[model samples]
Target: MCPHFSTGWGNDAMTSTIVFDPLLPWWLIALLALVTACGIALALVRGLSGWPLRALAGAVILAALTGPVYQQEDRKPLTDIVLLLEDESASQRLAERGETTASAAETLAARIEARDNTELRRITVPDGTDNAGTEAMTALSEALAEEPRGRIAGAILLSDGRIHDMDRAPDMPAPLHLLHTGRSDDWDRRLRIDNAPAFAILGEEVSMTLTITDEGAAPEGVRDVPLDISIDGDEPQRFNVPLGREIELPLSLPHGGRNVLQFTTPYVDGELTDRNNTALVQINGVRDRLSVLLVSGEPHAGGRTWRNLLKSDSSVDLVHFTILRPPEKQDGVPVRELSLIAFPTRELFLEKIDDFDLIIFDRYKRRGILPSIYLENVRNYVEKGGAVLIAAGPDFASADSLYRTPIEPIVPARPTARVIEERYRPKVSELGQRHPVTAGLEQEFDGEWGRWMRQIEVEQTAGDMVMTGKDDRPLLVLDRVGEGRIALLASDHAWLWNRGYEGGGPQLELLRRLAHWMMKEPELEEEALWAEATGQRMRIIRRSLSGDIGDVTITSPSGETFERSLEEVSPGRFETQFGGPEIGLYRLENGDQSAVIGLGPAAPVEFEQTIASAAPLAPMLEQSGGGALALEDGMPRIRDVRPGRPAAGRGWIGLTPRGAFETASVTQTALLPAWAVLLLISALVVGGWLREGRR
Candidate 1:
């Protein structure tokens, strides 16, 4: 089928003449013999002595030099082939290169199969993990080694120009050709969050920096983006967030809790994809420790409630002062006979007020035990980041209540005179459900909650009514005044709740949470955003008052921006997870909130995906004058490409014909046998002797 082919004579039909002349080849044998005879004749004409010996030596030298041999048979020359190496790396999988490579491989394979003299060999390359590039050249070297170098003609390569293993290229038997794939106009954009901290102190100002970038196909002059930030699910604050710059935002945590900061940029309406929009971070909030002064007005059934809750945790140091007797209303017995210890008001509240984090007034009245100046000092304590709790009995609505004292300026509400005794089950309000202290309580209740025996109705004008008593009056209220916090549990029946006298509630846990919250524990605060990352994926959570969270903005390490939304599964918890393409610290902002989370290991996925092809073999195929075609492409037709001709064409490369000596049958003739030499010597000697005698 190949046009370059020629029919060769059969072995039996082809017979060439053999010559046994070492001085010349068969073509020059006649001339060499003539030259030798001329030499011998010239010696005789010159009348030279030993002319026969001279002629004999000349003839022997000529025979050895000619190296004459007899030809046996000749064989047909084999066709040379060229192989094409194709690239199969991860980068090749991008765009339509994979499809192109596959098509080329098939086309070349068919062409090789159709040609009688050509064969197709497929060498597929797998991508090495961890960003190692394609090994196409290595594959070509291997293919070259397996086949005979003399038979190879040329090679072709099908690839994207991303070959990584160039160091081990082999000596090519043919020329190499490259066919590259890819379009020039590809582009992309990504959201990036540059740096965020993992821990920040509660109630302290912490700064976070954010950045955004455009990748691949960025439009020119995109600027002045608006970004929203939120902390612990507060109201979103918008800023004229500049593009291509790191913005420093100063943030202060309001309470001690797990502070989840979510940062986000608005999703660009017309973008390729929203996958890279928002970022999230979760930081734990902690206070140095809360020191409380427990002032016992008089020992009562509920007195232990305050002590038990505060003392249960080792972090809180309680300075308990019990007033056994008043200076005016003392019993006739001596002070030493009294069971209770004398109140240390001057030592606890007066001298050491600064050392206390919070002070509890348990049913204390204007008993004239302390001066009004001391009460004023307590109010100053509340103004300077201090906390206070009031456990009121019926005396709270009376004329002797602390509201009548100097501390009332910092008091949120004045207790009304009305007090109602009624049984009620403790329940969390809508706000309380989201508050960190109450969110997970549903699991503990198991549908049956504990009941309180009695609650006092109080009229509240300010603060949140977290718990209700009979007729829905606020039984427990929390309020902020100045720089301090105050809470009031109006009834003393909380101890009954813990005792389970009315079918126990989460009294211990609730009381514990309330006390800690009052003390400003970070996890007990409401409204937060946080994230945890495992490798390239991240799990983001937003805890907020609003059950539904808007889209979150994420910034990646490469300065790309993306937006994501939070789905609320519980009352106040909103959450989602995303796969991060790169490994770095990412910043997430939801509205005015922001957090930082990590993505990917410092080292990413171990192996990169390699496209399956063998383009690196192209050079070897070309050098061998063989066409390296993809098996996926049509296999090239192998024809006799002339040995000294260009390697590529419709057919295979030519194989060179060997010299005649390659097929010649070799024979060796010794100068003479030992017996012939001895006889020659004897004849010479006998002739010499006879001649001498005649002389």
Candidate 2:
């Protein structure tokens, strides 16, 4: 309980505030009053005739103890605060709504300022961050919190009423009214992507969910709508689909990387805006986990190089087998001890060779462990869209070299039977500087690669020789064999770089790039076009081995084409950033190569519901006794209304003016003088004593 208290709660413009200054503590004063009342009740209950007089004298004494005062305030009345919110979000800026909002805000400000004892606060709410759309309710709540609640008479909002955060609307201290900004007949057709996968495997059907909604008094009998669907900016395919129903569209990506899929409808006459008629969806195409077969012939130092590289990648499924002892090796140990299980050469190279994406032959040579027919099947595997990498040791230059076998057809280089045993730094050839696989490698390490101990001499017969070893001999050669690709490394001493013997070069990076190039990763292609986007900004990149790269042609989803030139930042990479891109799919092409990427989500949250809607604000307005009025009808007049009464009528809205004021003066005076109270109390007590004595 508090030690002190005041009785000064009731006050108004007409009535002087009643206050008290008691001589004792308020709790003690209350106790004294309670005891006197109890004593009076007891006398009355006992049928005493003098009880009434005694009670009167006690009341007089108590009244004088409480020092009552008249608090007549020289009130300086405060002006009523009115919050006017202007919604300039993306949805509000559509059509004539923006202009209407501007005009209404000006007129409202003038009318409010013209009124006596009224103040107006205009708040402009912008579009929410990250496409949260119109958050007018959030702004209103903040504005309400900044002002005194009693002083806030009303809140006015000018918008199309397309608020997205009504759930966060605050409890109103006064009426909240929204003056609608758009025409009554405003209608729009929007395409919505309800569900889209962020990533999907290439060459697989992606189930894309969507909807076509006609909002705000759409034309009657429009049961179905015609949509133009395009993938990667290809020629659109027209199809009629049912309206107002969730659609399941099946789409497939042609290549790995980002694929732009666009869905659009014709903009017919009478629609409010055409921006919502189209939508864009970008899905990243992913390559399925690669199956790589690594065959290591006999235990060697560099056998685990390819195995470790392949195993490190989560996307690569590696099947590795190293020959510990050939059949001719006669160690005094059981055959079962020498092998975990019998080698399944037929199962790998013959039966399921097509399942593997890449095959690595590390220091492999024919030892009659398997017939020459098995090696021929390996050649057939390459011709049937498979990749093979040959990391040659001394065995590649021997009599049993793969160049003498059926695999010679795909070998880009033939061994010269001379293993140069001198340390030398390998170098990228002039052609390698332009190829995507090795283009920027020299610049990464400043071309400071560790020296290798030995390299097999090779004569390049076909394809490109991208690297050279001792005395400019071909160290790495790459070529395409029918539907597959092959890479031959003349030296097995790349392990030296991985060992950091002379400050390890980019062995892991080079090998990873090489493996991806062999497996046909889109980013490693020599001739390609692609782009990366951050909002409406994009960096269009063109990679080409040829120096003469032409201008890149950019095609918007709306069918308008623009050309932008490229600047070469590296040997093969050409790129430039383009800004102010509209929200949709974009097609980039440079005659020889082409790519497609979407800049933003197909349907912005603002355009998702283009038609103005007051439904979102209904709960807030209902609780505050406010009503919605369309701008098509006309602006409503502001009126004063008593608190708790309905604040909206036919053509006007009401604001409650709380007569808030500050007290400037107080006059404390006794209701009766202390001498008069004493005299009255003594007479009443004497009379009561005389009456009791006579009875």
Candidate 3:
């Protein structure tokens, strides 16, 4: 049984409290106090008994001037909120971390809910795209912003501890504890490309710095790890590298355009994942200088056109030679007066032929200038990875035509001893529209092309005819001999188009593409497959001379394949786009052609440090009077902790008691009523007066 005390008004009790409201000005109160003090002093000096009565009257007047009331509140208790941040980022999905995180979250939620006056705010942090890795802290800050700060007793984070948004972490009011998820024995070996140039000069050595590191509890005395490197999916070259040390590698790109260099390390047992074990770096190859050899049997109208085309390019190093006089023709002019320099046939055709990227035989004919042995060398050069372009003239139909030489085996066409001199419009053939070198040339010229006045009749023996003139004769023929490429233009009147004859054409563009195609430029390859990435989307492209290209198969970073049919955007170009579901390497294949491209960083920041540890969030936890506990050991018990105390222990984590509440209603009552106060003051005055009278 309980006893209660209350005023004798009714069964209901009223609690009395005191509050104040001054009714008089400070100056008036001060004046009253001064007068009372003076009267008291005078009475004491005069030995008068009535001074006490005067003081009592002054006290009653002051008491009536000040208003007093009592205030009461009806408050409802609020539960303490504990923020739980569950990380579902990519790094957290490694090994058995996902399971561990799920388990820990469930246990924590149950424990928090079982406690009295406690609530759990579970917020899930996911992975970020555009190379932005785990942003767990950002999610935590957002959750904190949505809830009342006073009600937030504490925060518990379960993650792999790889957070990218540490700078965005909020200044928490309560303890922030990190329950790191991962095993102690979880280890990983990764290949790191420290420094690489985005563009490297072709045929020149470019230095790349790389480091191989072992994280977590790697085996002791581990050294000389085998590192494999490959360029453009070629066979990998293996090398021994010391672990955890940076090494410099000098590489030379084989050709121009994008070069994919893949660096990988052999997987070791007990490693976390092989995702970071291999890395990809794309370095574009650029030509420092293109060396071109131009051999002209005699000066002609198109000879200067070729010179101008090669000369206009700043990257080309042109070496031009014209055979003015043959050995049979010995004019009576003096040697010094004839010319200052003689053509070095041995240097251009035999000795240093491989030094040039392209060799053009413009209207070349056999006039006893180059020996049979030297011509044989040119043939051997073409068969062994060399490029030759032939611009034919009337001489191509003559007995001295190059078709009569040993190099004719590689020529795509044979000249029929007939030269037609009739105005005829040059048109791209059906195959030309499907060949990368001349695919869109007709469209670029608006389907209108200039006419050539002369064309040497030729019979196509092999190769593809991309352009035709004079009754559908082979005007331009392309062929591949062994590892080399050969292109032949049977007419020299192409220069007429350069002079804007009949509204001109894409003469410059045509010649540029032709030259680059013979040099095996990746962009001009007839059969090629490649991909480009923008954000999380990838544009896959396929180029083929064949009509039936079929579908393209895409393999994701996780080894999942998706097939998509190609859409023909142009003659030879087939393309489609894929919205990447995840970031990493993507492999694209169409029939026999295959290409590998990476959508994000070679080694994403999420997997950069795969061995999970609490070092990243340690500072934040320490600042909030909390500690890090691993889930591998076991789930910790949730406990209530006081403010400014340690919030984590060996087997338990703590949440602060907020003692928060909400006021439902309030009541205000006067401490003393007007009549009651008046009576008390009157009694005090009367008693003082009676005492004075007695005195």
Candidate 4:
């Protein structure tokens, strides 16, 4: 945009324009000329024959007063620029599309360079950040701004028509040609997650809607395809789902925590790629507010330990009842002095017993309070998937111990009718170190566990002995009834740890782990296999109650299997980290335990549409006077075409050659010398006088 001159496109450029610099004001010069003309006209009209020579002399004088100049410029021509945009995003790498694109680009570049005055600006479109897919049009718009619009003879793109940003396409000054890569018959099947919830109840059925879409043309006779579904990292459950339809699948999670669910369709032989054939959804399993029923025979120091732990958790609803007045303790103190809510025994044990997630009994000795029928109902509750925990004291060893009643069948251990009262530190059994509830507890305290002055002597009848008190007697036991789980803490002195007695052990940590284990949390499972993915890296974990396990078998999304030995970093835990090479689903197996995790995005935008089509760029090509020609036929021939003519044909594409340049030099010369104009005017005047005198 130079103010000196405007440009004109050609092989070489030069320009000229008129500029003025007058010796005298234009108005005064015009007046003098008008007066001279009138004088000569009067002489001619009055019959004087000398007016013609006088008029000629006057014209020469007027011309000398007005100075005139000529101007010219020199310029150098510039070469034309043609954009060659190549999309290298993930979609272009599928099948042989990448090879075809790369070869075609090389051929086109050679041909364009061979042309007389045309050069190529190669722009590569890589994967967009945050799954934006192929940004071919975005790159094109940026390249257009870098160079002169007129100089850009044309723009050529090489891609698989999976561009994500079509709305960002720029206005083209010249034609645009698309050397479309990928075959027309290229087909693929992608699993799409229509709707998925981020959090689901553990026991409730998690419903997810999904669709099986076939891009391009799928193989014929493929009505029902096999879909594999997995929860956490367990073995996949295969089922037949119809193609191209929305399917609602019901899922069940065994534990409350983060759960990874993968739904994948097996790759057919002729499908484009397996990358899009699978989808991964991570739904965290959350427990609905836990309803805990705490029934204490008499309020003790250890009762608040259980109450505080359950109350501190925002997701727990606690219903505690302490029997202040037993059936035999009829004291003279009136009921008006006591502060308590009505204890609805029948409602708790019969009417709505199943509503509670867990029932806790602390130091209860029957005392004829709950009739035998109510105790039988409590036993039946434990056999029907209900969880019950008993914290025993001296009452457990008395004649009326709960083990001597109908509830004894569900108790993991029975009292020996003896109570040991001595200062002794509690210790974890050998099997406890491997069990989920007590695992790593000893390590946490590291021989600094507090001592308990009291422990109820009990002999294991069933279930596992996880903790021991005085002289290796059972301190804690866990067992599974018909369809439920029950735990017995032999001593009620656990509150000693809470009071920091003798440098308190991990009282809160131990209680938290025990509660979660009783509620069946996945992370507290004794035997499990799972993998976690962050970006492209994956961490595979194996937890077992036994010694070292074998190597885990890793199966990639493409069904390629390999083995890697896990490192033991803990007592019963083994794991290893891997940098995934591709973006897709990964399955890991160690013996019977298997897990599935997604390494990258479930379905990348690049693979969402794999087939190459010209429909996306149809309007752009038509507006730019270009055509979409497939590279499958052959590499298009490069040729020079007029700016407005059709730039692409069956086997050829075109570039417009704009001879653009810049001004290199300029010069100006005056029309005539001042001295020469003066001499000519005087001679003309003298000749007119001499001629008039002779006449």
Per-model TM against the reference: 0.49, 0.80, 0.85, 0.73
Scored by TM-score, the top model is: 3
Give the alpha carbon lDDT tens digit for every residue of 539-623 in model 2.
9989887888989998876678988999999888899888644667777788868888877656788887777768888888999
Q: Candidates' lDDT values, in order?
A: 0.64, 0.83, 0.85, 0.83
lDDT of 3 at 131: 72
In terms of lDDT, the best-performing candidate is: 3
lDDT of 2 at 385: 74
What does candidate 1's lDDT look like per residue over 1-695, in tens digits? 11222224543123343444344465576677788789779867866555565555555555555554544343344554657566676566666767887887677667655665555567777665444557777788889889877666556667765567767777765566554554433333344554556667765788877776554445678887777777655677887777777777777766554565666667664443333445556666676566778877767887887788778878778887666565456558664434456656677667888787778888777766667999998888877767888877777777878788998866766777766665677677666677666667767656666666665556777777777667666777787777777888887767776666656677777766776776656455565667876656888888777755798888887789988878887878888988887655678888766776656432221112122233454455555444433333333444444455665553232333211112233233444434654566556545544644565
**Per-residue lDDT over 339-415 for candidate 3, one digit per residue giving the tens place of the 0 to 100 score:** 56765777778789899888899999987777788888888888898899999999989999987998989999999
lDDT of 1: 0.64
Please list the residue runs of candidate 1 whose C-alpha ends up more than 4 Å from where it truly belongs after superposition: 1-290, 328-347, 350-354, 440-443, 447-453, 547-549, 602-695
1 or 2: which has the higher lDDT?
A: 2
Clashing pairs in 4: 233-594, 233-595
Model 2 misplaced stretches (Cα beyond 4 Å): 1-15, 25-27, 37-57, 182-184, 293-355, 364-386, 398-416, 424-451, 459-468, 471-473, 479-484, 495-509, 526-529, 539-578, 587-594, 664-695
Q: Rate residue 692 of model 4 by lDDT.
A: 77
Which residue pairs overlap in candidate 2's backbone?
280-602
